[model samples]
Target: GGSIKHDISVPVSRMADFIAQASEAVTARLPGIRPVPFGHIGDGNIHFNLSQPVGMDKSEFLALWGEMNAIVHGIVRGMGGSISAEHGVGQLKRDEIAATKSPVEMAMMRALKQALDPKGILNPGKVV
Candidate 1:
């Protein structure tokens, strides 16, 4: 079974809340879904992962990747967390970051990207 991966960082103060609320939120959607959340508690960077329910088909559980990401990421956003903690915005998260950053922030990023890679040749779609 493929596990959906989310590397997110919330404030140290909100780490506990993020875990509790996110666990509750996802479980509410799919009963018996096991949350295997763990990581650096001091830094507030958590590899908030969910393992499939017992006896459920692996493909079926894998099919919920997008929904599970939205549910988990939504909670991360609500808590002012970075969707990517240790990792940068690569192919997997380029599109999703727009929702996380403000329009002005995004625009500034674009401007910087343009200044740095005027020809649009560096890691083409790996970031904003």
Candidate 2:
């Protein structure tokens, strides 16, 4: 009854391929894990939720969150999609975003953060 969810967005044209490939990737790596994907298809965003397999330990299944994120987010990135679309990067996805973002993009983001919130007081340890 437990599940881990990820928010991802691909271009409208690549939505179908993204879904198929993502599902295959997850299922391949984690057999028996149920991938229940849903969300704003019109806008090309998907809330990909992986349900724990029958009789699986909730904590153990949930522990694979990062691994599943990588599988799904990799497909999204391959399709030129964003791992955190609409939902800005927060603490939950900070490390993943850092890992996925390019050096120049991260630099620009850090620069903006410094320029706007030099004190690191507003939402500290987030976004940047």
Candidate 3:
């Protein structure tokens, strides 16, 4: 629990500025937090994770997963970044995909899913 990982997307135009502001916000809230901010700059997708403050217990730090997600994801989403980024909508982020993806897009996706897996057995109860 001593580390956290947040994969998020930002608009290409706001990538640099968004990361800067987000990192600053994290540092301000949790001094000494090790920000391991890295990822696909071309796609404006950044994995902004943080290691525990030096010498802090990893388990205790990891307990802040939801809080860390809130902070980082909040900032990233505010800048129009996808919280799921490159990770396809497995069970973990299905609802998030639904929330972010458009209706027409979702419909098209459903059609593709049905076409590929007519039995609906593939990845059942996952994406669609």
Which candidate number would show the highest TM-score if scored against the true structure?
1
* lDDT per residue (tens digit) for residues 12-109 in model 3: 99988887887887788778888887888897888878888997788877777777777877787687777777764577666766767789978887
Worst 10 residues of 1 by lDDT: 119-128
Q: Model 1, range 14-110, lDDT digits (tens) per residue?
A: 9999999999999999998988889898999999989998888989999999999999999999999989888667888889898898999788878
Q: Give the TM-score of candidate 3.
A: 0.77
Assess every candidate by TM-score: 0.83, 0.81, 0.77
Pairs that collide in candidate 1 are: none
**Candidate with the larger lDDT of 1 and 3:** 1
User: lDDT per prediction?
Assistant: 0.88, 0.86, 0.78
Better model by lDDT, 2 or 3? Answer: 2
lDDT score of residue 93 within candidate 3: 65
lDDT of 2 by residue, 63-90 (tens): 9988888888888888888888776677
List clash counts for every candidate, in order: 0, 0, 5
State the lDDT at 49 in candidate 2.
83
**Model 2: colliding residue pairs:** none
